[model samples]
Target: MLRDRDNVFCFTANNLDNSLSRLTFNSCTASSIPSSTLQTPPPITYTQPGLYNVYFVSDEGLPTMQVDCKQIRVLPQPIIEINNDTLICQRDTILLVANGPNLYSALWSPVHNTIPPFDTTSIRVHPQEDYRYNVHLEFTQGGGCAYDTSVLIRVSKVFADAGPDRFVADGAYTILGGPRMSMGQEYSYVWTPPTYLSSIVKPNPTSRPLDVMAYYVTVTNDSTGCFHSDSVWVRTECTEIHLPNAFNPVSDVAVNRNFGLLNNNVVKLEYFKIFNRWGQVVFETTDTGKKWDGTQNNIELPPDNYVWIIDGYCVNGKRIKKQGTVLLTR
Candidate 1:
């Protein structure tokens, strides 16, 4: 008998006097058996594991009968258990264990370099990419048996890249964006030199730098504890020049009396000129502090529209030119 296995038992009878005889068989621990009383007994099946006994009897033409008995033993089946599936970061190591009774040997398929002792019950794996591992178990003691189980170890890759540089006007904000990754998985973000930035810990932050500067961001994967960094340049644009459309130097003393630069940082004042309606050079000056007071050649000009042009350079070596019309009121 075999434990946890299907066993069949058959019986035969011999008649020495050349006469027809009847045969019968019975078992005390058999799960199933046929129901015939002919010269030969039908097959009997034993499913459970244990000790059993069988009895056989035969009746010939004579008054006497023959009897026989036998005993058998069955063994239990083998069981296998393996660790559950799990995830790991790229280049990360993990231990896998298998349990069973009388485990003779084991085999892991889809061999990898990081996995050692591929034929043992336990193995250490460091996979670079996603993989599915199969474990084959064998039992060679007491009714030998073989069974197989599988486990999956997924490897995630990590990466990070901060996007291109950006330009924004002075005192204006610009959005900073880039790529950030960890172990090809989720990660946290951190931007260095956080001056003029809205937030340093966010992926995309707003920056309004006072001067040109380079920004760096570091990304760390949560799972793998790996880190990567990238940089982006934030350039500052020159300040713009604002010109007055019409300045009344006669009636407006508090404002519009002079037509000149409105802001500072003017490196060089090339020239400032004023023209009348006939395109005549009414007034001109190379001094940045010079202003048009509605007079030319020591005479008060008439109330009319006039054109004014100013050219200069900024501190950043950028050239500037501004032109517009002004009104001289009575």
Candidate 2:
């Protein structure tokens, strides 16, 4: 029912003399002044929706009477109200849901595109700058008797950078979100793998990995939820390779028997070399995954001591070098 404004109607009685007529009119509503005793019952104002039968009766009261009746129809107009929404780390698409009809307009050119078309009560729009749609919903259901209602929708715009791909030292923590996470404020955020992040919802989070595997992050929006997302990679860089104090070079165990750096990945390896006590270079290699088997020219060297030196870089060209001794056991 449209109680927004009054539906008014006016009329004029021609060739009717007030001196010869005792005119009476009925407004056909219980709430309205039911009847008026004037020849031209000052314009009628109806506030409700429905069919109304207005009457104009002129009685001379002396065997003479005249009556006229007219019927008017009132139908409710469509109503639409849209609220302003916020986004950053911003949304690429948004859905506008409301009620109305006759939305033929060009006002949606700036907000986004219509996907899957649109119905009388809803529309889907895509990634765009910004927009304020002022449209009218006119209903002809009342046979050209329905009114038009105006609606305004303010679609906010926001942009985001998930930060840059970074390399952090193993067993150490680094903060995410390079420079800025968003261009605007007044919103919350979340990072994947809450297990590694110090605070998932914080703009910046500390990430620390303890093992040798890479962790992947994924984000999703719920059915009725709207949001935006981006991606970045964080890798572990091991500058200092691990070593054992001693190794059984001829032992049945492979990893436990190899006299070489324990790992080779992520970190940039420059050179790795091992020398005997007498300053004789027994093994040297710039290639990764190469290990010495306590052999000198294919002859297995007996129990002895060896010195090793390695040069490498990690975390953006930070130089690192180390030298140590390993006991080659029998």
Question: Top model by TM-score, which number?
Answer: 1
Best-performing candidate as measured by lDDT = 1
Model 1 ranges off by over 4 Å: 1-81, 99-101, 112-117, 127-130, 154-159, 164-188, 206-330
lDDT of 2 at 296: 78
Among all windows of 10 consecutive residues in model 2, the one with the lowest summed lDDT is: 215-224
Local distance difference test values of all predictions, in order: 0.69, 0.57
Candidate 2's error at 96, in angstroms?
5.9
- Residue 244 displacement in candidate 2 (angstroms): 22
Per-residue lDDT, model 1, residue 54, is: 54
TM-score of each: 0.44, 0.38
What does the lDDT come to for candidate 2?
Answer: 0.57
In the range 1-330, model 2's lDDT, one tens digit per residue, is: 113234443334437444344223344563255655554444455566677766655554535567676666655544545534534123455566544464333223233355644334456665354444333344456543333332333434333446777776654566766554453345456676666667777666677654433333323333224355666677777765566769896678865687775543425668888898888788887765577888878998878888999876654566678899999997
Local accuracy of candidate 1 as per-residue lDDT tens digits, 1-330: 122333544455554664444333344564465334555444555567777665555564457666666565656656777878887766568888888879898988767744666888888888887887888787877555567679988766655555688776644567886544332327788888989788988777888676787988887777567566778898877666545656666654565676665544565778888899999999888776667777777788898988888788777888888788877676
Model 1 clash pairs are 3-75, 157-183, 157-184, 158-183, 158-184, 163-178
